[model samples]
Target: MGVVSVKKSVVLLSLGHACVDVYQGAVAALVPFFIAERAYSHAAVAGVVLAASLLSSVAQPLFGAVTDRRALPWLLPVSTIVGGVGIALSGVSGSYAVTLAFVAVSGIGVAAYHPESARVARIASRGSHTAMSWFSLGGNVGFALAPLLVTAVVATGGLRFTPLLVLPALAGSVLCLPVLRGLAASAANGSVAAQAKRPDDRGSFVKLSIAVVGRSITFVGLSTFIAVYAQERVGGGVLAGTIALFTLYVGGAVGTILGGRLANRWDRVTVVRYAYLVAVVAVAGVVFVPGPAFYLFVAATSAGLYVPFSLQVTLGQDYLPSRVGTASGITLGLTITIGGLASPLIGGLADATSLRVALAPLIAMPVLSWLMFRTLPEPAVMGADGSDGRQPAPDVGHRGAVAVGVDAPGQVGDGDARQRS
Candidate 1:
């Protein structure tokens, strides 16, 4: 494959990623509307979030394991449509039970889409960090746009207009075709053979996953209620919540891109640690600070939390080089969605106490993440042929490489690595 083809494939994959993730964002974006239209309590709406998350969390790793065994590029488009359909039908029915069922179905679609998509992205990106960051950015952009998309269709026509939400999924599925074809062509040419298996560092991966769970709880909790919280703090009604959600998501785009560039200079673990430290303060500001400046803190919290997003995915892949699909599943899908499981707890607490009091515990999540990251050593870089790239040293533990750089042996330079059969 040529550089142009690689860039094109990555771009298409990113756009498709955005389309599917729009529903993920839409789930949270729809919360305020669900409250206003249905008169649902905070706990009730949080259950809706659980419906979307609970099944996805369980199924993502299973999907990843499947992808690890064999490629399933077709899942990309099929899952996209399924996810969109589930979300589109969610609001059309008035029954809460039916709504939960549809959302869970959507969660399954999301679960199936991620592992295979992440594998395909790795193939397309040829292991470039910057490229992967761009791919992650697409999902963040989708999240940023979800509020506007939901407000435009559902708010205007109420939940009945949700059918229109499927349009992006349709468009996204179409966008996936060219990339799928590219993968097929590569496979036919024997350039897309099974990657050489490497030793799995289960220990480091476990620690990284724990840190991700902490990050997930913070992000999902904020996304779930930031809009409502914004309304309470700023008195701008739905518009305030929309803006707050938008800021929270859009800032992630900046953070992801920044993370890629920073990785070129600092170790991924180091970058993640500092970012979490910043997140601790920013999340506090969002929960406690008042007035319109709340938007600024929301953006800060987003950037801080997201700087580790793509880096963590790549780190997970490196840590478990032989199980890239499983790594991607956990880093990109399972741990992230698991945060939604806590939404009900937060909601129930809010119902029992004030929203402010309910949100106070979230301030410690990033602190825990920072602590976990402190224990992690970066894994050895895997060569193109699946060989470990680290040179033996007395100080380097059994975990392998303690740091990575653009010029590191076996590392692919930005936009330069391409598969050759």
Candidate 2:
């Protein structure tokens, strides 16, 4: 049993997410530049993004089902090839039709990654916040770095090479193969089943799934449009344009770390409520900030934004300790469709009312999220480990208790800090 732990599993998954985010989000930042280079319309770029989201958000559940039923170590790698080829093709795409087609293809690669990876994280992490935090950070860092990396590539080698840049990550994401093989080893040896199990593993985990979708809608809104909002609504410079990304993700990274510690100290629900309230405040501040201090307010608006992102994923694992793959797909998969489906409408609203109009959901979504969370049964996972009156997970020991913290059988020393949780 000294082999894989949830912590190790999540760390690998986190790294994978970083690679995928760069693959999927590079064009989001590059769209305006693409339009300038190709004379495309704002609406046309939005359409391309919309196409990617449709593939990503809608197709995820199907992929999630595949991950659960099958054990293809090459799934992530194969998808990366498709996505990388599609992205590289985007710059060279001759027509709008071709561009959208390539974008959608890349989105498919982007879409398949999360559910599969999240399932891995959940299994490896053993059902703990630390595991979820690592996953969140991996994805956050990946998404956050997309614009920077893509822009640098575009600047140095030009847009044509943009697709080529994703090749490394595209290739590297396949590392999951070895990891999956290791997991099979553990399962075959009975270490996994013996070490871990959760009560909710056999159930639907539906409520947790709903909460995940709600948070994703808001998270994607900021990730997808905060830059445009920064430039247009807040009047910030292009550099300051990532205000939401910077404030939300970096702060959420910090908050998630703290949340892990706090979950150990306070109730998980308490920390979640506080995090959601902060999101409500942050979104509102962005929506109705007064003149002048737009930068200051946008930064503040981003505060606490990603906390729920980390929280919801962790919470889902806690809710359905065994169904991490479903929870992962539920959290990230439905997002491809539900929140993604809202993009064109959101863009259309931004077009009609003003760029600031896009900020509408960014602000209101959290309040609605809070309302949804309120209806949820109090999370028992917070007091897990025999800490809060509940029995230790029936057959699962600390391994089962620490659901998201499992390290996997082979990669024992990746030096990931989130695992210390």
Candidate 3:
């Protein structure tokens, strides 16, 4: 098959990713509205956030495990629609408990889509990091667009207009049908067969999860508090905060693109380690540096932190090839969410001490993440025929050259020989 064909398939999966994550992004954007329209207390608002994070995190791995045992292509469309509908209903209820339930519904939908979609992306990608990056980029774009989308509709039509948010989910699911069919076709061709022969590495996956946890804490912390930090320092109202948040998100999107290229050039583990190293310094600059100069470091910190995002997902799948769905769930869903669990502690610290003190701890997380990457070994590349699970011969070509396995291309059991070449 042509490279163009493979890329088009990956793009479809990326679109589904974007559609699913839009709800997650909207949840964060919805917080202020809840406080203003419903007069929710800070604790109540925290509860709402917790509802979304907890269900999504806990259910994702379960969904992954289910997909590993059986393909759930239908889940792609179902989950997208469910996620959007849940968010749409959130504003209809004035009761705090009712609102929490609606948010949790959205979280569950978010959880269901990630693992299966990621697994499809992996199979269709044939082991190309650049291709997978496009998938990750879609989710990032959805997240970045959330505030604007939610704010625009709500600002014009009031909080009651929240139902309008569901349109994306509806449209996304309709558009995603063809993508799901493509995934099914890819699996039938040989992706599913390749998986049965591959072994799962539980130990490495656990370590990678830890590394993901560290990165998540720093990232979530920045997203949660950067706007506030900017408002205090920059002396502008919501606009200044919005600008700072935009810088971080846009930086992440750009970093994701660069990470794919860097991984292709220098190898995945090396790129992950160095990115975290840069993250440490950048985060410190964000904390200590004064005035608008700090915004530069915020962008720098976002870039460094996000460079490892998609790489980690692929690494986890490589580490546990037999359970790509489960690995996707853990890496893409569960591990990163562990950061949300720590938000209350950080908030308490901010209450007791200061925002600077709360943020100061994030600088150390990247250092720990860097240390974790040092222990990871390069994963074995799949043979052109993904059926046989064996490492390729060493130094088959020039420096940075990938060694092709002793299997014919486009055969069952040969995943995508494209990576080895």
Strongest candidate by lDDT: 1
Please, what are the lDDT tens digits per residue for candidate 2 over residues 1-421? Answer: 1344545556666777677767655657666566557876546667777777786776776775454444334666677666767777877755789888988888888777776566555445644565667776776676667777766777666667666666656545665655655555554443222222447732325755665566666766665666666666556566656544455445555665666666656656567667777777767776667454655555444445555566665565456554444555666665444665666666677667775666676676667666666666544532323454321122221223222222342222212111111
Model 1 over residues 1-421: C-alpha lDDT tens digits? 4323988988998999999999999999999999999988999999999999999998998887666655567899999999999999999999999999999999999899988787677667777778889998998998889999999999889999998999999999999888777655544443222334357789999999989999999999889998899999998899999999999999999999999889877778899999999999999999999997888899999999999998998888777765667788888874558789999999999999978888889999999999999999977674655566532111111122111111132222122232210
Tens-place lDDT digits, model 3, residues 1-421: 2223667777777877787777877776676567567876544655676777788888998898766655566788899998999999888877888888998899899889888777656656766688878888888877777777878887677778999999889877876676555543443455312222345678878888889989988887677667667777776865676677777777878989899888888778889999999999999998889788988998999899889989898888777665566778888875446666676677668767887988899999999889888998767755555433332211111111211212232223223422211
Tell me which residue pairs clash in candidate 3: 384-414, 385-413, 385-414, 386-413, 386-414, 386-415, 387-413
| Global lDDT of model 1 | 0.81
> lDDT of model 2 at residue 187?
46
Q: What are the runs in model 1 whose C-alpha is more than 4 Å off?
A: 2-4, 192-197, 385-421
Model 3 misplaced stretches (Cα beyond 4 Å) = 1-4, 35-43, 185-198, 385-421
TM-score of each: 0.91, 0.80, 0.86
Best by TM-score: 1
* Stronger candidate by lDDT (2 vs 3): 3
Which whole-number lDDT from 0 to 100 does residue 21 have in model 3? Answer: 77
In model 2, which runs have C-alpha deviations exceeding 4 angstroms? 1-10, 192-207, 233-237, 242-249, 290-292, 296-303, 318-323, 335-337, 381-421
Q: Could you tell me the TM-score of candidate 3?
A: 0.86
